[model samples]
Target: MSDIATITAAPIGSFTAEVFAAHLASLGDAPAWWLERKRAAYATFASLPLPTRTNEGWRFSNLSGLQLAGFKVERVDPNGQLLASPFGPAQLNFINNTTVGDGAGARAELAARGVLVTTLSAALQSHPDLIREHFMAQPQKLGSEKFAALHAAFVSDGAFIYVPRGVEVPAPIVITHAASGSGTAVFPHTLVIAEENSKATVVDHFVSVSDIPHSALRTPQFACGANDLYAGHGAQLTYLAAQNWSRDTLSFQFNSTVVRRDARVQSLNLHLGGRQARHESHSQLQAPGAFSEMLALTVADGEQEFDQRTLQIHQAPNTKSDLLYKNALRDRTRTIFSGLIVVDSDAQKTDAYQSNRNLMLSDDAEASSLPGLEIQANDVRCTHGATSSRLDPGQEFYLQSRGIPKAAADELLTFGFFEEVLSRLASEPLHDALHQLIKTKFKQ
Candidate 1:
């Protein structure tokens, strides 16, 4: 098997054909079908070119900062402790795509209750059929198909959760993906399968260990991650992802959600770190009475850029989807939000709404929004809108008159603005934890 040094001379970044061969060799005794899938994914990744400024899907994105070269894939030993989360005890931690810890002490009980929480590698061997059925099954309708293929080619292990029918997990399952070494590239995958009438919540945290200082020549890190959420009939699934990579990391996250008959899925993403980050979310209501609620909050500061793209497809009649994305931009940061809602010809009585709101904190910051809708059914009700605004001077003055400092007043106002999204969460603890995470980002 070839190592990183041997493949560094190849032209296709660190993910050369030689590197892919070595990756396949590392997965000893893997099934033939899975291996073939990886080979095909790598081929797809290699054939696609990087996105250019002319691409409509990548409009207003900082295409110059996008780089697929110079990053190496290597396992990093845990150097420091993983950040603690107040969510619950069921947690899995990974450093450089290698599982380091599994804290699900309630595993036995969960297992008895027909809940399966394990690493992707383990699930591949133990539950091959389930893994094959839903792993990266959704198409990359939004942009970032190349990155998604790269993730599938290089992904080794991640969190895999399966909740059987009628089982309701009492607590949220937490998964942490941490990058440790400089120039290290990690592919994180999370697949949650909630069977009919089941209920579960999964939270994912992406962080960098021993983060390098922003003043120094920051080493470039790469993180390409994806998650698949499947909610069966009458099932409920709630997913929350928090991304806080290092200051120099280039991050890409793709989410695909499938809501079946009478099922409901709610997903909220918190973007707080990385020099350049792109997130694509696609939610499909495949059956009647299905509903999807998509929410996101981004804090872009100090030259950071966050690009978000979303698509809501109503495939069946009486389906519903609602999307609300808000961003707070400061300094010279930039943010882009592009979203579309599609109602199929047979999807009558569909109700869909999309909104993008930005709060500009600095005159130098830039925020771009594009909201659109495609309705083939006349009975559907769909609406899309975008708005960019600054903090209200009256609210600032009112807070100042109440003895709050200028900075404190601004923070309070921002929190008040964000509370609209956070209040939707049923778990108050998770909401508070996310609120504190946003506060910490402001201090940095």
Candidate 2:
């Protein structure tokens, strides 16, 4: 029987009505509309079953080790620091869904320009209609429908940003989410709406507390996060996210981008930490002359598992999209990449490309790739390819002959492989910071 058919009617996770009730109580007097939506979402989540190995979308994933127990709705005190700092003029620091610090100067300036840089709760009260229209508006086309519903049911606070028409922000907006306490479950959401002819950049950083007193006895955390990006006509948006969860943590991040006429959006995700991490990303070109660029880089080591699924949909004519994902594996780690490109019947003259490449640094590491395309338009040009390769022996030997250690030589080659994706970032500071974080992982 098919995986979807074999799915049991009973839910398989730890989420129950009691947990949902506790989560609702934590919100404390939120808008009625949002509360009603949450109740509906919780029902949906409870009805859906966990994904099994028989599911094609979850092929090559480590479903046997997937567990959703031992997590609770908890708050983390802010540590008065930004995990990803100095890259943006406007910044919001969220530790376990609490805002601890912000850039007042940048926020004030953006406010003067009629931009909205505030928390999701605040936006729901101040701009109820606007938030209702754009928040999680897109369908969860990927295989994370249950998780997406879970996010909506429990998510309390996150960053909300809106760029007005004809306005351009000089710097990026940063949102940092950190989990400090063990077993602290966090739901972080970022909603961005850029108006016509507007331009902006957003950075999301996920990190865990370092230097645990007991260290070895620390329990793992759970992070279920989502982001929605909407680019209006003639607008441009650039989004960057870096996930560095604790090594014992389990994380799920879903992303959706909608592009309008003459609009463009570029998003890059860097995955570095987690015992098992899964990411789902979908981009839709809703109008003519729209473009979407999707990029991702992952470094997996020490029995870690990174699974990524992506989709690009061309719903209109004269649309374009490009996707590139790269992964480097060491030790006994595993990585999986699955991507698809779809061109609608009316989406003529569409140009789409998808590629996934993996580099193996150890014989024990494993990587899987699945690339597909569906084109109903005869005039569309869509191409996809995936490749898994190892470092050239000659290059490695040459570096070793120059007194470089074998480990260092491999690290250098890995960096060279990843630079292709990192070089696309427009912000110098953000680029450098990402590079440094990758280097730290290599050192570890």
Candidate 3:
């Protein structure tokens, strides 16, 4: 049998090749220009080589295991359960890469206001214009172009959210993606566009339907995905994402948020699974008064490794961006966080801050942080800092004195430590939901 290790050459006529071909053929006859763009993107992807140690954006990233040597993308069958992962005032679910659960006449209400919430495939057939305008619109310049290309090549389904101008969603929207098969490869994309003066909150959850053994694994599937957030003038957008892929898979996620004039955008990502998972996020403050807040949390256990990199660019004067990422490492796991803040020459009065803090739960775990800044505007205030340390023994002891077990004490203290970031979530239900998810992590 030919194994992944022995496969050195790319096979153009493989099953995935046919799958990609079918994707192109089934496009409901899109504009020639769009199809041409897809062809161009595929060509670019096939032409670019994987990142190496010398690449600055990939520095400190574990790249050897990123080989496309194994795995084939396929459709996941019917699966998923109504997991009660702390719900907010509203909820939406995506089970096994498909939509599920309709609550509170939500679909009708959104439709009434011209807000369209539908599957990516359905939207591809119905709202081709929207997809044509914003699908993978931004340049993938963050050094993850290879994975982004893979996502574009194989992606067939995802969530499409379009908030019309001046519409304000009263409740937060929830989306969940769960894997069911033993060796499943799923690609989930979320594209959200908030028009002028609109407001919306979207929470995305990625989970596994079954708990695969981490220490003993057979086939290691790959998870390649992307998310895009577009906010127009005076708009407000909040996104909360939790990634809980199968414990033995390779995962890559690239997310970008574009903030327009006077727009406010906040995104929070939580990482907890996969043998080797790398996440990259980029946010651009494109105009004056634009603000962005980025928050991320990771819990690395066993031999798992979570690598994360981020960038915040103040492209216009008086723009602001604040980033805070926290990680908790247990067992012999490893994590790396390298981030940067850039203040352009025209970005006068730019206020940008970048911070990464790690809480070590075991002596064998490792956490690395590198924070930097490039500021060309003399009048801007830009700062970056990275810190890695163990849990505060004093705080642990204080909780223990109150009759809490040592493990419980440590968990409680850790939760308190993360509250500062979680509290920033404007939705109470989302904050509580995230708190519950973190609580379950300590029990594992």
Clashing pairs in 3: none
Q: For candidate 2, lDDT tens digit of each residue in 122-192?
A: 89889989889988898987788988999999899988999999999868888888777778788999999
Error of 1 at 311 (Å): 0.4
* Model 3 CA lDDT for position 132: 84
| Candidate 2 accuracy as lDDT | 0.87
- Tell how far residue 249 is off in model 1, in angstroms: 0.8
What does candidate 2 score on TM? 0.95
CA lDDT for candidate 1: 0.89
Question: Quick one: ranking by lDDT, best first?
Answer: 1, 2, 3
TM-score of each: 0.95, 0.95, 0.90
Show the colliding residue pairs in model 1.
none
Per-residue lDDT over 229-343 for candidate 1, one digit per residue giving the tens place of the 0 to 100 score? 9999999999999998887999999999999999999999999888999999999999999999999999988999999999999999999999999999999999999999999
Best by lDDT: 1
RMSD in Å for candidate 2, one decimal? 2.5
Among residues 3 or more apart in sequence or in different chains, the pairs in candidate 2 whose N, CA or C atoms overlap within 3 Å are none
